[model samples]
Target: MSCRVGSTSSAPEGLWHWLGSIPHWIYPTALRRDGALWRQVVLWISGICLMVAVTGFWIGVLRLRWRRRYVGGAFTPYRGWMAWHHIAGLVGGMFVLTWMFSGWLSLNPGEYFAVRGPTRDMAV
Candidate 1:
């Protein structure tokens, strides 16, 4: 029997790794029923996530005034919840953007990490 990825949509259980050949109907090895295109799906999803992180960082920076201060000479006009948002966005947003960027880079969409197969000269 061959093992398959779990749909996770209906299955209450979390996830499972494929250690050996097992029937897919019996047990799935993934969280979704993405079939063989799971990697591609994840790549596209990662791109969206990266864009969100970038937008968040951009907003965080724009919300703050550098040269011109607020009424009380404050760099930010936000107060209470908004103030917390500004602080977290300025600080946490950086970390989130960095993490998403690194993950996107790791995907190697430009074939930068491509490997060449054995040449004809190589021994059989």
Candidate 2:
């Protein structure tokens, strides 16, 4: 039948309900019921990706800066595909770092503001 959209049940019904139910089909009911495990998995993967991205970024930066300087100039390293590879890695590493960091933060959502609680009395 008909699915309720807002207060009315006369809403157009095609694949909207099916599309919404896809998540249920993909993830197990237990995982859906308790999101802690899912969040932990996401955090672990994102953390690992973040570390890899950081190291890759450092290696790319170092190679582009120091290693290429002796050959000729930093920008003009190789005369063919290798030069493009170096440029791509340097640029792509920054994007990867940002994406992984954002994903990690998403799984570990926290409050930015720090509110202090009541302090204990010195007399007590």
Q: Rate the local accuracy (lDDT) of all candidates.
A: 0.67, 0.63
lDDT of candidate 2 at residue 84, scale 0 to 100: 89
Evaluated against the true structure, the overall lDDT of model 1 is 0.67
lDDT of 1 by residue, 10-113 (tens): 33232233333223322334634654355565567788878877887887788788888887877888887988878878898788778877877776655577
Angstrom error of the Cα, residue 15, model 2: value is 22
CA RMSD, predictions in order = 8.1, 8.1
- TM-score of the candidate numbered 1? 0.62
- Clash pairs for candidate 2: none
Score candidate 2 by TM-score against the native.
0.55
| lDDT, model 2 | 0.63
Stretches off by above 4 angstroms in model 1 are 1-36, 117-124
* Clash count for each candidate, listed in order shown: 1, 0
Q: Which ten residues in a row are the worst by lDDT in model 2?
A: 107-116
lDDT of 1 at 71: 76
